[model samples]
Target: LFKPVGLGYASMVIVFFCNTYYIMVLAWGFYYLIKSFSSTLPWSDCDNEWNTPSCIEIFRHQDCKNASFANVTVGDRNMTLLNISSGLDEPGHMNWELMLCLMAVWVLVYFCVWKGVKSTGKIVYFTATFPYVVLIILLVRGVTLPGAYDGIMYYIKPDWSKLEEVWIDAGTQIFFSYAIGLGALTALGSYNRFNNDCYKDAFVLALINSGTSFFAGFVVFSILGFMAAEQGVDISQVAESGPGLAFIAYPKAVSLMPVAPLWAALFFFMLLLLGLDSQFVGVEGFVTGILDLFPSRYYHRYKREIAVAICCLLCFIIDLSMVTQGGMYVFQLFDYYSASGMTLLWQAFWECIVVAWVYGADRFMDDVARMIGYRPFPWMKWCWSFITPCVCLGIFLFHLVNYKPLTYNNVYVYPWWGEVIGWCLALSSMLCIPVSLLYKLFRGAAPVHHAPTPDLQTPRRGPADPRAPPPTTEAAHFVRG
Candidate 1:
């Protein structure tokens, strides 16, 4: 009864953390895209408090605090607003090392996509996946840092405000971060044998994603501590502000270091590469959904090479804005609307309606037993039917009760138009699910999910009823004896 419920709960949590980590990865990608064309380092003493006093005198009147506007000094002159407040104009204010890391990441991503879907499949052995490696690296490096404990302590030392904040953040993070309902998971699942144990695989993937985030605190936080020590400030002050932690905190670290540019590029590059994995998956999800829905579009045109090429062309066209200065904005727009809250809520809702109510629990389980060769526990059964729907419904209700747009910096809100467009695009992506369900329902076409059960040819014995006069002759003989 509760087996599916547990799956729901676990999938939700895993999805949430998955989104958050991916955002960090996105930031890293942004760093490298910038680094590729730049001649000098993006950050410099030329842009900060190190700038001379006269330069600072020019923009002293501006709202530097809210603006993150700052003064810098270089060669006997103070330059204010030359750089601005703490980090780059970009949120998360990343560094070189992170940027370099992002480059390596994207290069791998591009290469993986270059050949087509099959190539991507081949790369999965190492490239199309491998975040766990970076995550483990973070765990080790984080705990070893001088002020590692502070980040961990602070992370959970919640203010009630953060609960409200994190709740929303967590929801959105899960929606955008996870590629489940968007068709990535399903499409990926398609690659497995018809009877592949998807429920199990989903659970494993979700665990890996969430568990890493929990552990990532040590890696991410320790670095924050390292930053704090250099700035001679409390850990809280230098701590990651939000999902933008890497971008903002990392740059400051590079700034403090004597030989920063090299490290800065590397760090930011790594961050960029990390994003490619998630980003490509996101792209792939839509591609798969399209191919699945409109068979004629590929019309058996879905050859891996041809399909991959077309998808690449489409991605290039859509992603062109990412190459521009406003690319970050595009990423943010996608991030806000395509959040886990929205995706999972819808996934949970429809998955329930289709599997539980539409197809029937017995049928669903039969499918599972057929594919996986064993029945899910009662709990698992219940979740696909009930728990997942409840949680998803709850999240959707929460959003309707309280929703807001993604803000620029901490305070600047996106316009209503941007919000509307974002939601529209987001809604369009999830539409396939309902369309599929309706088609299956109306056409009576919910394809049989499980393998056909082989009929038993021989008569099976029921346990003898002890209450019955079992084998009267034998009993009588025994009594007589």
Candidate 2:
């Protein structure tokens, strides 16, 4: 129960709540999966075929021109949802009860983190691997569908003109998907065995992650295409929706299938597992970073639980805005400012600075080489040093040029002060880097130990290796534990 310092324990406060929300959504994904197997499931009553060129049909169809027709039938409720009138109904307010429910969700997340990373680390083992399993299942099913190829073409068939538009999205997706630059990479990098092959591990992780996203498109689009074929509608109509793609779009597809409910349930459940690992690991980074930067801040005390409790309370309150349909608004704002384009740009820039500029490139490369038994290629060094910074800087400016404030109810906008408030909020955890450096400058560097920072960096240690290869003396230069 160690207490954090400062008048406001800002970063901790943000992580506690934000991470909680993220995991809750992930849990919903899991819940959906479980519901799929049951006869009594969401949107299960309808037996109507989903759409014309079914998702599977579209995925499998390479010609993109023709498809075998599936008999068309549409369910009652599904039709009602798509009706024009359904779109106009406005509660125009937030749901207090759900907000309170969110509080409970946050509390559950906090309890898991009570024991810190040691406890949290165990949970990631299951959460991280399950999504891949689900993806494989979906991929197998999708590829067999007649129209899946058409759906996949829609995903990777980039309009080069739209590349600039999608560049931010693609970059943002990479950033959020991998949780890069949000201090997670930096802190995690610190934990690596000094000479662990980080580059290889990174490549492998990328391979797996990107492969999942790409393959997932096949499954998702195949189903969509299947629905399209069943409904006699075009694929464009299906792709136009938002999260509705999950809630409305996919459920409709299931209803048309032989065992619709079961598939829906499994798909959602898989989402939960993926999200659970993502949120917990994110929170862990925040927790580890705080402890690393300010050892005395939360020294033994009852403050840890207190911090957790406070986060739960605030999350529900802020999230209560969801009742008004503003919940999505609030989420979108936080998602954009806290974890979106701005955040990634900040991360990419800062990380490069920390390792390349502040710490020095040769030293950083030396550590990377030791961990994996090879140094970064010349191109990598150039990217880490010169190219990355410029790219990030340019992109970050684009974020500013396109800056739009988040509104409370699509009317009253968050003030400029609110943007300041948001940035200060996100930057709180990183205060340690500069503060620690200042302390060293004034008091003289402390003796090296297991830590990977300046006082400790004779060479090696930090940024936990997910799973890497054999190492020698270079491992000591980066990390061993």
Candidate 3:
């Protein structure tokens, strides 16, 4: 397929928006990780300053009005600590604790990747493996808990209606998990030797990624079941998804375990590592994309460090809004729009067209055969050529048709202007594709005569190859090497 520089640029833009808000989750993790050092888990009881009269103790889980785990009870409504603020309009002042944690996270990321791959490689040894160890420990403990079986059963049982409703969410999860259209994998993959068996690596990565998710489900639901049983509630009542699950339900469940603080520490530490690992790749992708734009000019003179620092600082500043009392509302806005499933699907559709239709799926297979010594499964060709694009386009249209305004905690609907701003965020990245094309078309591009050589001994030049494309653009330079 003819490589479109804008598509690459668009992917980088998506990564930037994703990394900006994504790292804020790590700050929350840090806040909880630090709090886990306490004699008792802060959210385990309704005794803390943040707790309200509606707060219910974890062990005495009685259904209050609109009750949620380990938080306030309003009339008959139960609320968690997460919903303390009435809505987006009430975003109070900055939370100093979370702000400090956000800074700490950025600093950690800057230090880890400032030296580029050297520092990143060393840290991955721990960041990648430690999560599995914690997961295993948690899974073992979760299974042996009083109501673990109930949780496991809840997880295994399928709710067809719920699945139908959330199919788009499931698609987005797959894209996010696989790093599709993010360019992080593309940037990282560029580091490999030309002859590396990426075909094999792709399958390995998918298997491991999906396997980890399935295994982690057991760890989560088992504890959730135990919480439900302890509280004399249904698993559905105690089990929450996303942030509510991580910050509220799971923390409350762990508090009931023996040595609650230790369990809390381990769980949050795992989250910290997971967030850090993702942050590393995302930052690296963004940095690598930016630096490569100017090739030979910025490889020295501490340029990489400066780039990393500036990126971290900018994201940290923008993230300040998320640490406010009303920050969760802001977080929801970003999460719902920035790098969302719709944006990803739009990108994926174009990618499939460029590769499978415009570029020729047969040619791609041939290229893969050249690198891996054999073509991949024939089914792959069908997937790229027809199945993938059609499916993405179909689901994307369905999502658009059924779209609703943003809401928080299933209440507090966002204002019309808020929805406008969210669409702007989504289009900011999605528009990069067409914008880049127009830029290239108006600026005029030299057709690539051949693929770029991989030799990196020279700054902008590679070993002579008749098949190599001229180094006219950043993408061309990348292809050259």
lDDT of 2 at 327: 42
- Overall local distance difference test of candidate 1: 0.50
State each model's CA lDDT, in order: 0.50, 0.55, 0.77
| Model 2 lDDT-worst window of ten | 80-89
Per-candidate TM equals: 0.67, 0.70, 0.88
- Best candidate per TM-score, number? 3
RMSD of 2: 8.5
Candidate 1 local lDDT, 75-176, one digit each (tens): 111121112232113333323444344345444555665543555554444532355566565556556655567666776577886687678667656654
Write model 2 residue lDDT over 1-481, tens digit each, in one string.
0111111233343354456446436433443454466675544333334322322322222233332332112222123122211111233544344444455556656776666555555666676777778778866776666556676776667788877767876766777686665554444455445445668777777887888777777778887776665555666655533345665567666566655665676677677666656665566556665565555755767655555456445555655544343344345446545555665566567667655665667776776676567677878877888998888888888867876666432334565665675666456544534554555557665422223344434444544663453233322222211
Q: Model 3: residues >4 Å from true position, as ranges?
A: 1-5, 60-84, 439-481
Could you give candidate 3's per-residue lDDT for residues 198-248 as a string of tens digits? 888888788988999999999999988877777666777776666777887
* Comparing 1 and 2 on lDDT, the stronger one: 2
Error of 3 at 455 (Å): 13
Which ten residues in a row are the worst by lDDT in model 1? 71-80
